[model samples]
Target: MSKQFASAGDMAEKQTSFTEIGDGLWAFTAEGDPNSGVIIGDDSVMVVEAQATPRLARKVIDCVRGVTDKPITHLALTHYHAVRVLGASAYGAPQIIMSEPARAMVAERGKEDWESEFDRFPRLFQGHEEIPGLTWPTTTFKGRMSVYLGRRRVDIMQLGRAHTAGDAVIYVPDANAMFTGDIVEDRSACYCGDGHFHDWPATLERVRRFDLDAIAPGRGGALQGAEAVNRALDSTADFLRSTYRPAARVALRGGSLKEAWDAVRAECDPKFADYAIYEHCLPFNVARAYDEALDIDTPRIWTAARDKAMWDALQGG
Candidate 1:
């Protein structure tokens, strides 16, 4: 099955849904697509993760307007993914926040990632021209930063290297809620293209230690209650374990990329077949897993050319 390239599809036109996770806290979810979180303070608001473009971010702005009139004061980047951070200018947030590692990754590979992602998932980059440029964090922290939302508190912590070197989570102790970037997902495909699979499970375990009543995952609906939170964590861990183990085994045996891909498919497809973006993520996921299992510590840079080449090799050019 040779991989086929299709022209970028139309941008999603559906209205994003905003669900209140707690008092003064909201989650903006669009279908099972990328999600953004909102925290309203006494004086202003902070938006976590800008969508792909200002046009898309304005939709989120509209959602925030429906809730309150407080101006947006902060824009946080969970990581330096093009889809998550490029639309930041839309908020006109004075302080853009991110972990120090995330900022470094942006400085290192942000441009390549921007070009690569736009090619791979153009639909997500609606109003691409609206992107002022790659987003840079005005404020960067080493481990954790406590942000005060008036009296309420939001703790942004860089727990571990999982989804990317700079992955961070926003925890609200008052609300007993956590907003995990791609670090945790509920019934959504894990994009392991730039992930650390072995470390991701342990990182997730760290996240499990939190006493969360609810969670707004990077993708999917807002999980309500402890049971939903646990399910999300367990499912995310399971997805990583299942995909990485088989892919690593085959790669260690000196199997070809296609063989590794087939091995992973046989192991994961039965369970994750119905999950979002499962097919879309498999090739890149297997490639990274294969590399890591061979003791490749860092994820290889993914450019648009490499994406197609890898797809062709694994799927039969």
Candidate 2:
């Protein structure tokens, strides 16, 4: 309780950018906040990753309006994180989608996640009061599903579990572009609270196989061109390895969580000190890594009280 979450005091507004990564494909990114993607189809539009709240979602909607007047017919949520799906109501899209596991997570811990995330970062939840309740997917798929916005085909698939158990990536074949939710971060730290560390690299490899020309990642700017996309993938992989190795070492050696924290910081700081959300994500990442190292396959749900207890335990050292 003595040390507040790194994001708790992050009240400064971030400059927003709407960049077109592919033909009719856009990425809406704030300085280091959560990001959203847009896919303008032949007739209608498909939006990827709703913002944290209605007011936040309105910003993406405004950006969408600037480019096309097409109605958003489908909203695809990559995962069940509150920051990513709580604002779904703003879209009012007739069909909202998520992976089956993601919806299951929503049923399991959606409220806890919403309360936990809101307490951790107030800036993202600007209009928290406007959020009716937990966002539910009108439709869900087990491994993969394809939706057509007229001629454009969006392949939403659960390649593997990385950021969450049911992470889905939106791949548009026409543009050879992919919208990777938190699975791929460009110059931003991956929030690994509910992540699967061992499964992440393999999932990322599944993404790399596409050899995408462009990508709208979960955070940071839009990745255009093959090189930038690959660089982000490599760096994200490196970040995950860097974070996990030290924590795993500590946990396997019967060291305390505090020791794991220090070890992880020692390894990650020099490399990712300036990355967006690096500090905010470290403790949770370390805790999860420690758990994963101890053979815990599933990530523990993060309630607000658990967040505080984890923070306090690490700070106690």
lDDT of each: 0.88, 0.94
Backbone N/Cα/C clashes per model: 0, 0
| Every model's TM-score | 0.96, 0.99
Worst 10 residues of 2 by lDDT: 1-10
Q: Whole-model lDDT for model 1 versus the true structure?
A: 0.88
Clash list (residue pairs), candidate 2: none
User: In angstroms, how far off is 129's CA in candidate 2?
Assistant: 0.9
Candidate 1's TM-score: 0.96
lDDT string for model 2 (208-291, tens) is 999999998999888988899999999999999999999999999999999999999999999999999888999999999999
Give me the runs in candidate 1 sitting further than 4 Å from their true place: 5-15
Give the clashing pairs for model 1: none
Best by lDDT: 2
> Runs in model 2 with CA error above 4 Å?
none
Residue-level error in angstroms, candidate 1, position 99: 0.5
